[model samples]
Target: MLQVQGVFKSYATPQGPLAVLQGVDLHLEHGSSLALMGESGSGKSTLLHLMAGLDQVDRGTISIAGQRLDQMNEARLANWRRTDIGLVFQQFNLISSLKIDDNLAFQARLAGRFDPLWQAQLIERLGLGDLLKRYPEQLSGGQQQRVAVGRALASKPGLLLADEPTGNLDEATSDEVLQLLLDLLRDSATSLLMVTHSTRVAERLAHKVVLQNGRVADAGER
Candidate 1:
């Protein structure tokens, strides 16, 4: 569903142009799960941003579901992101003012695909039934993360982009949340590209890729 070729990205810093990715190539089949493993400066998040079309690439080609991302202008890409991709951040970027239910349904509604039945199912599956009326600040870390996961899946996005989705939770909660996310993605036949620090989590996915020194270090049969 996604293809990338000869991707390169660099940024100008105080020192000089800092290269994060160089001639990177990747291919992901539809409805599959993949993990991105990398050290701090390896550009894992930067690659994700490029893959999701959130950031522009200095050079290379990216295509999602047969649509060439490199060809889309800003306005076109913005709409594609809303309709085709679901993003989950490490910070659980929820609005403090919106209720839990509202936050979970916000993106889905924006995409014109908010289903009440599916929303109720997500609330139950994420174990946020009672916390629906509560605000993001009122919920525990795990609860808030669950809400974030729910929000990402509400629109039935074709692709899910998650960055350290379990970073803030305890080990037990992290495992629980990770399993929940995998299960939901599998059920929906949704493709997932996630950045994770844990090997155990990486092992559970269908594919694992390690980025190092601005190139792919490890990507073999799982």
Candidate 2:
């Protein structure tokens, strides 16, 4: 469902360009899950951004579900992001003013692909049914994060790109929510590429990939 090859990205600093991802290669099949692990300065999140088309690659090709993102212009990329990619950030980028239901369906509505039935189901499954009318700030950190998660999956995009989805939740909440996410993704036939710091969480995924020094240190077999 996804393929990335020979990706090289860099950022400029006072000294010169600081390289983050170099000659990175990745492949993921349909409905499969991949866990990416690495240290603070590693290129895990950078790769995720590239895959989601949130950032441009200096040199590489990113193809998700047979659509090559590297060839898209800004407007096309935005459209692709809205229609094909679902992203979960560590910051849980939920709209502060929008209520739960609206937030969940925001992207879907924008893309003219809103599935009201699926949205309602996601709200209930994420335990946000009772808080549908409430804004994001009205909830606790965990609740907000779950809402963010619901928002991402609500769009029913083919590829799910998550960066530290459980980063802010408690251990128990993390496990519970992740299980829900996994079960939902499995049932919905969505592919996942997640970046995480915990091996315990990584092990739960079908494939584990380690990103070290801008390269693959170890990759688990399918």
RMSD of 2: 1.1
Q: Write the per-residue lDDT of candidate 2 for residues 1-222, one digit (tens) a residue.
A: 999999999999999999999889989999999999999888998999889888988998989989888778999999888888888887889998788889989988887789989987897789887899998888888888888778888778898999999988889988987998998898778999999999888988999889999988899954
- Candidate maximizing TM-score: 1
RMSD of 1: 1.0
Off by over 4 Å in 1: none
| Residues 104-211 of candidate 1: C-alpha lDDT, one tens digit per residue | 999999889999998988988888988888899998888889899999999999999999998888999999999999889987778998898888788878998899
Backbone clashes counted, model 1: 0
For every candidate structure, what is the RMSD over all alpha carbons to the true structure, in angstroms?
1.0, 1.1
